[model samples]
Target: MRAFPAVAGNETLRNGLPGGLYSLLSHAEQYRLLCRRPDLIAPAVDELLRFWPPVVEFRRTATRDVVLAGKEIRGGDKVVVYHASANRDESVFPDPDRLDITRAPNDHVSFGFGAHFCVGARLARIQMSALIGRVVAELPGLELASDAPPKRLVSNFQNGLKELRIRWG
Candidate 1:
């Protein structure tokens, strides 16, 4: 139907799929950090979304004048919500910078909130869960192959890893 554009689906597959993979890899990395406590794997996924979300910024338009964190914006204002900043907000997440796998009540906004939430959120989580579970189950000794850090793309919209050099057990 012309109501829904073909380009939207194409972009979703191209971007969403990779974003899920990125979240999964980050979960794998967290396993290394909390190897002693293997039980932390599940929450690590949420932690990754909070620590390093798939995208940096999203856009929205305010329909009514309101104050967000004491800042007032009039109606019909275009807003650029930064996920990276909100995820690490100290007021909301204590010890925000420190990654805690056992963190409970993780109200992360990686998959937007309210009316603008992603429709494929559940599917994406399932994919990440399966991939992360598989990697942890099959490759227990996997490690980063290179000492050099991952090369992140210089983009304002998408948060992606240009290359993730790793070694399989």
Candidate 2:
């Protein structure tokens, strides 16, 4: 029997989409802004992607020996790249922790980078933008149903919420 390989591309929709939605909805101020200005949906989606990248981290083999942050890594050493950390790097993103929907030049690595960049990145962005746009238009009154913290998916590889309780009048 031939074992089927995991369809990693689905992660963009399965994990990424929901994660982005939850991040936006949970932040009431941001949600209201998007509802008021539909034109900001695209950038808002990008910010959401950066703020909570679904693929938390990925592993790759180093091609050459190098010293990173004082640690020497030999060729072929396994290196873990944490997308979440890179997205929030203060040097790259000013006031990184705060979500700025209008942030320009948002060179976030939520979709990976270089040769390993995700092919479905454009599709992911479009999907996020469309979904967010529709939500803003149709559910302007939507809000978190509870003040309790959301239940997050317990996986080091994926950053996502298990459920986001919401209500609309």
Candidate 3:
């Protein structure tokens, strides 16, 4: 880890691609992605979860009468926790509006918290990371294919870009 600082400080190495995987080696690399290096897999899935979280709103019913944030709730009353809102909570994240690649300790509740956590979380993370890694590697110099701006979805629940056209050599 100590070597990381010295390597990071070198400007020439900073901008260059390290040759672990290239677009040409994809067939073999892809097979390994399916079977090995699960550690790499988790972050990839987390990235997509950060990008497009599913199960937008989760509702929980109070076992008994309760009050939270000065709001009164009776037993069997359903309270919704909007994951999308919580994921972008400004109090928790600096510049919550931006997508940061290196944000650590990102305890976003996209997958729910505590006992309610998703069972497929591990699998989900692996698949997403592998998929994204492959796409980026294939399109190393990828860029927007169209000059036109994107058209966003009208629904509040979906955070998808309608179109993101791109082409690269």
Candidate 4:
């Protein structure tokens, strides 16, 4: 009973952190920036979280009747909120498709929003920051092993890599 929350949180980090790191490595320009500027690790992590969120979407039951996007959603309705799509909203993020590590005012919904927001969001950020920083410092020559794009986990629920081959000197 007591260990359930801890295990759940660990699972989230396990799934999310690697994908975030892989996302950084896939983009050559961003990876270069991380190598050059250690200070940018935090922002880079945030941008990665926004650009390639691990959890693609989550289902929630609506508690009250509400009109969203001019569509009626009644109480007890099952709604699937796509956080990844929301993070890439053109109206919200300028040049949404581009992975800008320096993106400020980055109010991304990667860790979710409002009441549904993740309780371990801060811890996740810290862990990502440390990992990115260490990888940049230690594996300066790290790069993708193949020119071909790495395979992704084929699942509607998780946005993660099946494998990300890399080599470092």
Candidate 5:
């Protein structure tokens, strides 16, 4: 119910939409630098999610006692998995801090892992792709209006933006 109207819903969009748009524009800048390659859109979205995932972290209760990284974890313990940090792990991604749209085998956990993965992952990607494609097509020279910085919302669960200043004609 919170996302029934993603853009129009103040309660939800206010906390997410701006940050999403900021990330989308970041991808747009990359596209422009790469000479606006049509083949890069989808890959860029994947990279963007890895680089600046909207959901910062999530928790899972250990179903059974386990050992990870040489540490013992008891059953029923709450484990806070920082998806954003995992996405940038150097072992999984070489030069993980850099945004390379062509980065394949991304294996990013932005959408969670295994059975916990988001059910809306595919749909969300499609929508984002369409929006990015449309923006590039309709506004070939879209840009930020000024040098003003993006306003961010400090959050524990989500990486959010309060507002993003932009201009395009």
Candidate 6:
């Protein structure tokens, strides 16, 4: 119930990985892995969150009456933060549309800006990087097979490839 799908604009990890994406990690192991790789962690946690957003959209209530973006809102007003859209904000990420793997100091909002960040951020990165690294080391020129286009999930909420046909020596 915690994880969701990526969007059209959020395919960095998907395109970065080999054979498409693999699997999701449970909550317990997620924290354990992050704790292990303390040196290589970053807002890349943000990237994974962007790549595999937990919730398509989330709702929040205003703690106090306030006005936002030329709109007036009373206290307890409901607000929905689209994590996916926030991750692609041009103001936050220069050339937000581009998927640069080496993007450093990336403070993407996909994992929530503050304390609300995803719990499994660490494990997701370890698994993802491991897969990507394996492909690069084990199979150079690895690419999608030229038989048929990969299948789609048919749901925009979940941006995932149903299958990735690949061949490599």
Clashing pairs in 3: 44-129, 45-125, 145-166
TM-score for model 5? 0.82
Write the residue-wise lDDT of candidate 1 on 40-151 in tens digits. Answer: 6567667766777777788888999999879998899999999889898888898988767678878888778998787776766666556656666677776666566666
Q: Which candidate is the best by lDDT?
A: 2
Residue 166 of model 6, lDDT score = 61
Each prediction's RMSD over C-alphas, in Å, is 3.5, 2.5, 15.0, 2.2, 4.1, 9.2
What CA RMSD would candidate 3 show?
15.0
Clashes (backbone N, CA, C under 3 Å), per candidate, total 0, 0, 3, 0, 0, 0
Better of 3 and 5 by TM-score: 5
Residue 63 in candidate 6, Cα distance off native in Å: 3.2
lDDT against the true structure, each candidate: 0.68, 0.85, 0.51, 0.84, 0.71, 0.51
Candidate 5: worst-modelled 10 consecutive residues by lDDT: 4-13
Model 4 C-alpha lDDT per residue in residues 1-169, reported as the tens digit of each score: 3433453467567667778777777787888888999998888888988988878888999999999989999999999989889999999999999998989989899888889788889989999888889999998888888766677788887787777778886
Q: Which residue pairs clash in candidate 5?
A: none
Better of 2 and 5 by TM-score: 2
Q: Candidate 5: misplaced stretches above 4 Å?
A: 1-21, 24-29, 33-35
- Each candidate's TM vs. the true structure? 0.80, 0.90, 0.62, 0.90, 0.82, 0.61
lDDT of 2 by residue, 1-169 (tens): 8553263557556777777777777788888998999999889988989998978898999999999989999999999999999999999999999887888879999989998788778888888888878989999998877766668889888887777777898
lDDT of 6 by residue, 1-169 (tens): 6555343224534532422222112122332344343343343344455544544566778888888778998888898887668768787778766544435757765445565665555555666666644544455444445676666545544445556666553
- What pairs collide in candidate 2? none
Sorted by TM-score, highest first, which candidate order results? 2, 4, 5, 1, 3, 6
Of the candidates numbered 1 and 2, which has the greater lDDT value? 2
lDDT computed for candidate 4: 0.84
Better of 1 and 5 by lDDT: 5
